[model samples]
Target: MNIPNTYGHLPLAAEAAGAGHPVLTWAAVGVIVTAVGVCLVVLHRRRDTRSKRLTPGYDAATGALVVLDRLSAMTAIAGVTTELGELAGFISLLRVAEARSPEIPFGVIVATLDDYAASVFTANYATRLAADPSLLDSYLALARVQGVKLESARTAITTVQRRIEKLTGK
Candidate 1:
């Protein structure tokens, strides 16, 4: 006599009766497919939103251009001052940068330059600012010369960034 075997333990009819295995398996597969579909939809939407935000033709582009323009303007101001006078002028420009472009990470550079300028000024004119008001004017004139060079340094940073973007097609 032949007997049906369900994995050598029971008949197929007995196993099928014990649980609706086929229906449960199909339900699980359906759920998995639905979950995968949902995930794909969400991922696609996120990618689309990100693309819109990062596109070079959008608001990011405008912000970058504005920053570049401001840097260029500062550079032009720096060109007319003498080396010593540049220092004071650069200090002023760095103040502007700090106010307008706080995200540029230029605070350290500006602070270093300011500290050096102050040290030089104090060393040279510590006794003058207290005597003659005209002495303060003279000190400012000298500081302005150094300020211009600091402005040039800032401009160099902007130029370097532009070059990198060009090379990378960014």
Candidate 2:
């Protein structure tokens, strides 16, 4: 049996041997439209993902300050203010440094406090103090006696407070 080649092997052909490429049909148009719609949807989802994944800097700073505030309030020793004053001075230095270099980690302050509290009593106690503000007058005195330069720590609180308030207003 012999099979007849009804149509030429070339898919695109001119009926009169002079017609150009075939005109795209509605099915092709539908496919193109569907592809464009899918691309749009992917772009939208990527934007949403970026927004949702962004970390909250303002909230984190507020939380850290609250812990420090609580620890300050709970501590009760003669010149407790002075001992913590040195630590506060360190914070002030950090704040100023941060102003100069925003890449500074907030954890630096937290870690310093944790170490100072450990020298006085225990890390657990310091953490509790962080949660509630306990004792450390001697540490403050030693810091002052050794010239830790706590002037900035003493006044940096107000600066930090103002900065936070301004951020809040925005």
Candidate 3:
């Protein structure tokens, strides 16, 4: 004699006619499926907010300031080659800073870098160095001579850095 299993995958009609209530089994399956759906919805919402969460405290904030300090220093270089070198390092660090600290609006810095690369250098981060690397020296010297124009960039970077630090209490 085969003993009927209420929780088995076998459908009710497939089992002995009087074994159990098929309706009850179907209702239980419906409840399980609904619970799973609710859980998935909750997790999806949480995943978005999770990345924005920054590590709280002074250390991480201080580290972020260091990157800002370097970016500020990079603005002082009028030399194309030196500036490009600084840009490369700064861009790499900026990506890290953006990921590590949500408080910093890194996209703004990227825009500024993009503008400088396009206008002052007449080339982007990738192509700038490739074009007559020898010209970098002259271009930088010219920019340095006209350094007054870079002051605004220095101010903007510092201001953003301070704002982010203030939020971090660093």
Index of the highest-lDDT prediction = 3
Q: TM-score for every candidate vs. truth?
A: 0.31, 0.27, 0.37
- Compare candidates 1 and 3 on lDDT and give the better one: 3
Q: Judged by TM-score, which candidate is best?
A: 3
Tens-place lDDT digits, model 3, residues 70-140: 54464433354454555556656665666666556765555555455443433353366566697678766
Cα lDDT of model 2 by residue, 97-144, tens digit: 445435434445444444444333332545555666544665456445
State the lDDT of candidate 1 residue by residue for 1-170, as single tens digits: 98876567645784867864688878999999999999999987866654443333223223433443343333222333143364455456555554554444345545645543443444425556777777877767756654564455455445534543443345
Per-residue error at 33 for model 3, in Å?
A: 47
lDDT of all predictions: 0.50, 0.47, 0.54
| TM-score of candidate 3 to 2 decimals | 0.37
Could you tell me which residue pairs clash in candidate 2?
71-133, 74-133, 75-133, 75-134, 83-140, 88-153, 89-153
Off by over 4 Å in 1: 1-19, 54-74, 78-170
Residue 33 Cα positional deviation in candidate 2, in Å, after optimal superposition: 29
lDDT (C-alpha) at residue 151 in model 1: 55
True-structure lDDT of candidate 3: 0.54
